[model samples]
Target chain A: MRKLYTKKLSKKDQLKDLEARKETVQFLLNYSKALRVVKCRGFTFDAILN
Target chain B: MNNVEITDAVLVREYMQGNETALSKLINRHHHRIYSFIFSKVFDRDVAEDIFQDTFIKVINTLKRGKYNEEGKFLPWVMRIAHNLVIDHFRRNKRMPKFDNSGDFNIFSVLSDSDLNVETQIIKDQIENDVKELIKELPEDQLEVLTMRIYKDMSFKEISERTGVSINTALGRMRYALINLRKIIEKHKLVLTN
Candidate 1:
């Protein structure tokens, strides 16, 4: 009975890990997409004097 | 072996032997990380670029004078020099706190005074895009934490809450993210150009 209970718990842990990884991946994809549209304004040293 | 395959110590030796391209290669290999580190600290694109140029000019001059001591670890040595230059800039501007006891001297604290020229804006955007490309290589867990910490400038607690993880897990992911990113940079021999 104890062995079976441990196996069930391990499976639950694996599912939780998978869920976390999926969430993380979704966040990164959205963040990278957002980065594509972000604008920045600044000058390089070469451009400043020229 | 070609210049790219040569080790940093060997390149330094070749540079010392009066081969200008060897010096150029050495600079090209490490300039991106050094530049990004300075930019992170200063947050002023023009100032960062100037300091980046100055850091290398100083490096070349020091190498020519035979003053560079660290033989094998050129990048870290040069990074230290660049960091000191950033601190020196703040000191010269009188913006650095006298004691810095509170330890609140962050780049975000320094206000930038850059005019929004179109060309400059485009250049800055290109650099950011390049950085994003590098960051994209990180694992999902690491990528999420790193993006939040860096681009979003979010605290670990905020990141944990948003990601639904404990603070420790959030911090761990960030650490792994940095390690993974460094590995990717080395594996791909990425050269970030501005």
Candidate 2:
């Protein structure tokens, strides 16, 4: 991989990134869970259907 | 073509016909390419793992229900599911996060609410405990950052200094930790809250 150097983040940008992460965690969590409910339990026809 | 490798199409057919191990063969055969594809898009291992597992979960469901009919195109079909999952990941991220960590940034507000009913409150307590336990499962750096941020109530700057990492790296660890926790919670169908 190339060493693609970048500039340092400003204090404002760092704080902004922190705040953004704090906010988005919940939504991402919910979406990931919704993708599968059958895997937790065994893979059965009734479970997949329902 | 006897020396030729068994094709994915053949594996899918066998799995559908009650050969359970065929699926594992298929997974092993394509795991690297599919995983790399997912990781390239998300650029995070935890998120990529979730997406990869979810992709195959969807695949198994389709195959079990006898709905997989994309003959001779198994890899592409799987790739499509992975692609859609990547889209789903970003779609959720793009939404305006509903948290209100506003000007004061009160951590308590994010952690608990006074208005929950009895059942939900109890469940939330259990989930919180489970999340705390899950902390031990995180990578060392992520565990360190999460421990300090949530329990010790340290700001990112403080965590960055204590951990000897940039603020961005600190936040990244927290994100990966939460992502893994949420994946486990969902896999078990644990209702963390109302």
Candidate 3:
């Protein structure tokens, strides 16, 4: 777990860091989305339908 | 001729000549790294997948239209396309609330509000934790770049200046870190939640 040193952070800064961290997590979760998209492209729906 | 030994330019030419296999060969050769690169950006499986397909479709259309000019560097070119698509996704969905980081935001509340069941939520959280743990396994150099960029939210130029390395070196470390992370994910067969 990454720790944010909040002792020195102003409340506003703390909230900003929290928002940034949340955005990072959201971005990380999207990682596999690209992999699945690429993999799926390899399989042609035309071949299956035929 | 073995498709594997042919150059990217040759493959592009063959593909443009209605040789579908040539395109498949090109895709097979570069898909892993390209996909890994895009996955590192988007993180969501379905959205990344859509962009990946769109990138290639654009690649095909560009080739057919004789717009592809990068003779031997097809992978980077394809990645550029995927990166643009990710940017477009965010732009199009700018109004959608991606994450709530307010004081009232709770993991339980977020999970419960979603359509996923409790068990699925647990699994998803577990996978996210596992992914974070895997990131720690990276080399110090790679980890430093990834941490500063992703966790600290630093730009590559800032990271380079702070770490006493060239901007290219910082960018290269990030690329290697993503590639290594992708390898780890594949080796562990870790399934990420959509």
Residue B152, candidate 2: C-alpha displacement in angstroms: 51
Per-residue lDDT tens digits for candidate 2, residues B118-188, read 98789888878888876787788888988999999999999999889999999999999889877867777
| True C-alpha contacts between chains kept, each model in order | 0.00, 0.00, 0.00
Q: Write the per-residue lDDT of candidate 1 for residues B92-147, one digit (tens) a residue.
A: 76864433222435564455557767877888788688778988988888899999
Q: Report how far off residue B179 is in candidate 3 (Å).
A: 43
Q: What is the lDDT of candidate 1?
A: 0.68
Candidate number with greatest TM-score: 2
Worst 10 residues of 3 chain A by lDDT: A30-39
Using lDDT as the measure, which candidate wins?
A: 2
Q: Name the runs in model 2 displaced over 4 angstroms.
A: A1-45, A48-50, B1-3, B96-194
Residue-level lDDT tens digits of model 2 in A1-29: 77656676554443331111212233333
Q: DockQ scores for all the models shown?
A: 0.01, 0.02, 0.02
